[model samples]
Target chain A: MKPKYTSLQLFALTALRVSIGWHFFYEGFTKLLNPNWSSAGYLNDSQGWFAGLFHAIAGNQSLLAAADFLNVWGLIAVGVGLLIGIFSRYAALGGMLLLAFYYLSHPPLMNASYSLPSEGSYLWINKNIIELFALWLVFLFNTSSIIGIDRLLKRK
Target chain B: MSNDAENSKLLGRRNLLKALATVPLLGTLTYAGLKKHSNTAANNVEVLNALGFPKNTGLSIKPGAVGTIIHNNNPHIRLGFIGVGGRGRHLMQCAGFAPPEYVQDWMDKHAENPDDNRYQNFLEQDDLNVSVIAVCDVFDEHARLALEAASNADKKGQKDFKGITVKRYKTYQELIADKDIDAVVIATPDHWHAPIAIAAANAGKHVYVEKPMTNNVAETYELKDAVIKSGIAFQVGHQGRQTESYIRAKEVLDKGVLGKISLIEVTTNRNSPNGAWVYDLHPLATPDTIDWKQFLGNAPEIPFSPERFFRWRCWWDYASGLSGDLLTHEFDAINQVMNLGIPHSCVASGGVYFYKDGREVPDVFQAVFEYPNRDLTFLYSASLASERHRGKVFMGHDGSMDMDGVTSVYVDRASIKYKDLLDRNLVNPDEPALTFSSATGNIDAITSPTAKYFAKRGLLYTYRDGKRYDAAHLHIREWLDAIRNKQQPSCDIQQGFEEAMIAHMATISYREGVKTYWDAEKEMIVKGNSVKM
Candidate 1:
């Protein structure tokens, strides 16, 4: 079957995926090098319906430690997989899940209170959810097969 | 749909299956890694437990015999006084042991104003079941005055005090050795605090020592060991522990109202000379009346100077200056509310820029204590030269707490995370938010304009049934009740040790001109490279 998308469209989608991958990779890398860094503070500040769940995770040392490990390593793994276009679909799914967790924790609901400053105002759809859907589009298009390592692997 | 598009979708599903197949393997690897990390975390917890980390004590207020008259069911506790100076006299007044003359003078002064809180508080002291049996001081003036206050119980119109014989001793050792004295209140110079306290503990007498607990780290451990070994009820005079605002702050903190506090700023400011510890020297303090040699004890031998005797807090030889004298109060109050113990490291920098009266300690000081484990930092700043007050503030992720007489919790306005709760009215908005204030109208000590402002907002004292109570009196009553019940007081030996160690870290950092770390396991200050002081 012939590919449907034009080269420019494929290029744009690949660029979005790689850029988002780099963002995730840098965040994970910085946290990895910093011994004192933890997500506990962010979790503790969680608001709205899932606040209790987030607070519980923050309160339990074991759970917090586990979250720290998974969040950091998962970001790095998903970033690498997406950037190189190897296992791109799985990475997209994983990235969507991570972003979903962040979005649910804070939930860009209207009029909710939070200590941290927001990048932009939103009722339900914020940057996290926006990027989450973008990742979904990247997965659906299978942009990796067009211009990523997946293409070479498939050819081999 | 076209046959080519359907065929392409089928191809995409095939590719997705291949990508999904690798995820289970990645999941397996992640699970193994987490298992190894959990074991390491368990070991870390064990180590923390060994170092007395993760304090579990909760705030539980046990009301003592304050504001109530006690029937003489048991024999009164006989208390001996050591260094009957300013603080000692105040404690005596709190214990209802002030001489009849002193009470009469106080009452007479407040006679025109029948609603004076100080006068009322002083009157309430008459019901305390304690008697000053012996008084000791290096200064004859202080000892003689204390003796007069203790012995003269026959003043007209004051029928609560019955005339009791009081003995005056020249030395604390002699006073502590007295078989009739069951307890001792040591309010001597900072250098003499631990020595008298340790001796009194060894002599089987309970002790109430003033703050900073010890002159140095070595004495801190020595005092702790002595009190623990003797099993006496030792109370460090951090009277702010009884402050109602702090007690309520603890309650709010326990509720996680201001979630995950990471930074706290504490401060002290005073504009007056007396506030800077430039206390008045007694006119009668002559070499003949004062046992200058006995007062020197372990301090550097010097000629009889009334300045050193009266303003001991100005010099390092006898006192810890701002860190011990003032910072301890701030630290102890925060510790009571937060249960924050010793910091991992501290860096202090300040100088005696204002008062240049040959003082060994600085008049302006600032210290930063870092607790990496808890991801928190405490900053302390004090200036005796300025009257501008900077109240304590605790910064958390959800909100920040500004603690004064009236503590306030402010939520974050720019928070996206709490948008849902705010919209649903589950939490109050940033403006016109929740606030807590004392029920009592006002109390004494709100003399300053700033204090009056706080008082107007009900910030100062804790109130019960529309009446305010003195924190010092409550603290003293707690100590006495602990003495009667054989239980540890609020600021016990362990608390005193931590308070002294942290306060000393600030002092050492400022004096030595270096950063200091608390070696929690060994319980000692680890000094860094020295800089110019």
Candidate 2:
């Protein structure tokens, strides 16, 4: 029982989803191609609330490899699912969870700092949090079902 | 056509369009990703060529390729220690021996916290196939502890370890003369390092003595002769020679990356009583429990004081203080890279500025050496009251290198050698030109200040097969490998002689209040105005 959207609203929302999906896909794809890429550096530089957990994962090789694996492939799976509106609701939620991890691991706290540079200064809200918010809206809206593969599936 | 047929055909077309609408974008993404990848690779080659490193593939000297080559049939070396103090025990641990209590404690630490990898690294250390058979220390307590550690050759828990007869030789001479011992690790005071090593070398046992390898120039010459005459493997304990970053530093220096190097500044910063060598007097130390006369060993004859016995580094009679104790390390690290063998002249100055304790050695000191041939100056400085690390820096006309745990290079702003790079914005003066990590053999461009921060911390290291190697352990392993393979170690007696001479020159300069000069042609420390001004 979602609310109806105007054609313009639907187009804009769909474009936002596709853009985010493309960004996630490219990031994960590049990491997959780079044989030496690992999440160790980013995890070691993790600050804020979940630093302890992140550092622990980074210290152990096996756990670090698993974390790197999940991070790379999870992004790809979520991106592909969201792109074509295949299980678009679940994909949106998964993307939100990943964003939450990123936000918490290195949140823009007033006193805390990061060794990984940010593109811009922020206060309690970075690009990760912004994307998470956008994904939340994407989850609430039904543009994907209206004009996506979900539309064709809905016929059956 | 019927109305139902027309409606069905239109619905099928709309559904087909909707279901596959964004699929074409995936094809477009593939094209873009492929294009970006190829462009990045081409850009990398262009940058390499611009830097005049077209042939550079990876590390100039890959540690994996030239690292310790442990033969399958390596001999089992029987080791005996002359001193079992803190440093002595660490050397023993590096040689694959740790007391049962420490073994259990390490295990407990790992069990309490999974992230504690010290115990894990100890376990993963290669079995050097060696055992301690004899130990000699002036103190009763240290000798007893050495015996306990020696018997735990397996480096395992208490239950797993069975006892062995670790003979406690009351004197180093007795320990060296033991027929069963194949090598002697001399970790005694500076005064005892040469005499004991000389005696051990004469006794046909290989020697690994701590640095400053000898207390004076005379001893240095005599020890070199004795080692050569004995025909035994001799290694000086400069563990930094085994440090991966330092190895890479040498390779880079040989390439003349820091062109026209004019100055090399090395520093030591510490702030603690222990750091100042004000070690606590052992409560158990007494004339009955300690060999006072034996500990004197050519030092001035005096009534035994527990402070003198425990804090021997604070005295001129036993050790050469900051010059020989600390500065030798910095000097040797430079020597390892630049091969600045023996400086032409040295001038040193300092006093007991920070620690007011009745110690002959200065707590803050500095020394400068002139390498006239190379047109370079080496400056060394120290402060025992400050913990701020002013790292070792090699300054040059083209660039500068700052080395400690990592080596980072920064191009000079007005560098003519790199003028093209600067103008093209390929390299930045404010940012690091390159950050080299020996762990991965990768030189990364520092694009941001944040990346530079992490680069300094050396966070790029990943576990090599989930095992960590200690530099000291590697040093000991190399010595053993040399012994087995019948080759001289990296820091052989020849290198040790140079280290001792330079360190002695600094010591003599500070003590005599005059500039000291090493007449390399005559191998003499000319004290007066013997050299041309």
Candidate 3:
């Protein structure tokens, strides 16, 4: 069964998806082009329950390299899929996973201070948490079928 | 038929329009992204260039290679140790000979935190193509520890392994005379440094001796002459030569950023018994276990009081006290950067105001060395009772540089060189004008808060891939490289000669309460010119 949406709902949902896609795509592309780019600093700067896990990855050069490779390619892949609405479900899932890692690594809980500078003040509902929920919304209430390349994908 | 064809065409056209709708946006974004990154890169380069730094000094962590030399490329060199005390054992560990206890320690640290890769790095340390062939020490326990360290293969800290046949030489001369030994590392006391190194040099063996090269004025020239006459690769263990920041600091000084530098202040502060050279006298330390005669060397005969043997730095007969032990550190580091050879004159005064536990050397000391040629005064101050941080600072007419922990440059509010930058508001006097950071390996003007945060975490240190190299290891590697390549090591005989003379001058000024002069033509310390003690 196909989902139904008003013109306004469709525009809002697709715009949110495309905006997040642009953010992730550019983030990945920038890192990809940078020869000195590594996730070591951000990973080493992790400060939550999963800080140790991230630190472990950062400490090991080969593990850090793998993480860096995955991040650069994953962001680009998720961005492209969400932008064009091709494989939108998988893209949304990948975005959620990345966001979950980010959120876990630097959860904005009480008494937890991050070394790396973040955009705005965050208690619990930070940008990553907000984006995680938004990506979930994009997963469940996908407007890509009506307003994107998913429209063509529906026939198959 | 016409209605069906029109409907199908409309459906196909709508599908094409939806599918290709965002592809043009993607192309536009790609173009925009390229422009943005290119512009940012260009701007960063310009800003960095204006600050007089290379562009690649951004978060650049150099790998923990042997000092700066690749060791495996060179052939194997046999090593012999003359002193296996704390410093010597550490030097051996740096040369990839980790004792069982040290290996266990590093492993335990790693187990506690995966980030601590000391054990792993020790194990994975590049094979420096060197073998510890013989060990020598006056104390039995230290000798045994050295033997254990030398025999431990692969630096894995594993027990019950078939190890090398490390011969334990009771005296350093025997160790130096070993034909199998290609070179000797003289980690002995200040008194033994000259004798052992002189013997080794005469034997055509390369030498790496510990700091303040020798104890007295006589041996200072003697060691230099021997090293020159031997023509062997000699290195003084001022491991500060391998320090990354010091290297960068030298580069910055060479650039003349600190215009007309006048005063250089360096210091040492500690608030502990051990810090005051009251090192623990081991339980097993006894006349039977220790060769008191060998330990005393040529000092006036005294009963074997374990105090003197264990805490040798307290006596003027053995160690040169704070002047030789600590002052040489600051002097050599400054000398490495400033090229201020031997000072023109030195004035010093201090007393054992703190730990007055029958120690002959002063607990609080200050030495001011005047370099008339360079037009600068180098001041070194120390206190064993106070736990204060007075870093190495260079005050200049245009700016001041603090290269104690991190290489930071601050422009003078009233300045000649930085006038244009200050007027243009490109550099703020309130903050660092430029910093060669130890944490990020950056030369950017990192904010004070950011620098402090990392420093508090103990992350702001010289990097051998973020974790600083065991500088002693690099120093040893450099010595070997010099031996193999026939090149001069960083802290060579000439540097050692100046270091010894400088330290001796300070010691003499303190001892005689006189303003000691270094007569350039006569090449000897003239101490009778000032008020006597």
TM-score on alpha carbons, each prediction: 0.63, 0.92, 0.82
Worst 10 residues of 2 chain B by lDDT: B459-468
* TM score of chain A per candidate: 0.93, 0.94, 0.96
Best of the two (1, 2) by DockQ = 2
The best candidate in terms of DockQ: 2
Position A11, candidate 1: lDDT: 74
Instruction: Please give fnat for model 1.
Output: 0.00
lDDT of 2 by residue, B1-533 (tens): 69889899998898778777876776687689878876665655564554444535755555454456466536789999999998999999998888887898889898998767677888777888899999999899888777888998667776777765699999887887789999999999999999999899888999999989999888888899999998899899998887667776776677777788999999999999999999988889899999999999899899988888999999999999998889989988999888899899999999998788888999999999999999999999999999987999999898888877778888888888888878877777876677666655566553335556777876655222334677788788888989998889989998899999999999999999999998878999988677984
Clash pairs, candidate 1, are A111-B419, A112-B418, A112-B419, A112-B420, A113-B418, A113-B419, A114-B415, B99-B149, B405-B459, B406-B459
* Cα-based lDDT for every prediction: 0.75, 0.83, 0.83
What tens digits encode model 2's per-residue C-alpha lDDT throughout A1-156? Answer: 435888899888888887877887777887777665777788888888888899999877799989999999989877876777767778899999999999988989999877777779999988999999999888888566765677777667
Docking class of 1: incorrect
Interface RMSD of 2: 2.6
Can you tell me which runs of candidate 1 are displaced by over 4 Å?
A1-156, B1-75, B115-117, B152-164, B420-432, B440-460, B464-467, B529-533
Alpha-carbon interface RMSD for all candidates, in angstroms: 14.5, 2.6, 3.5
lDDT for residue A35 in candidate 1, whole number 0-100 = 57
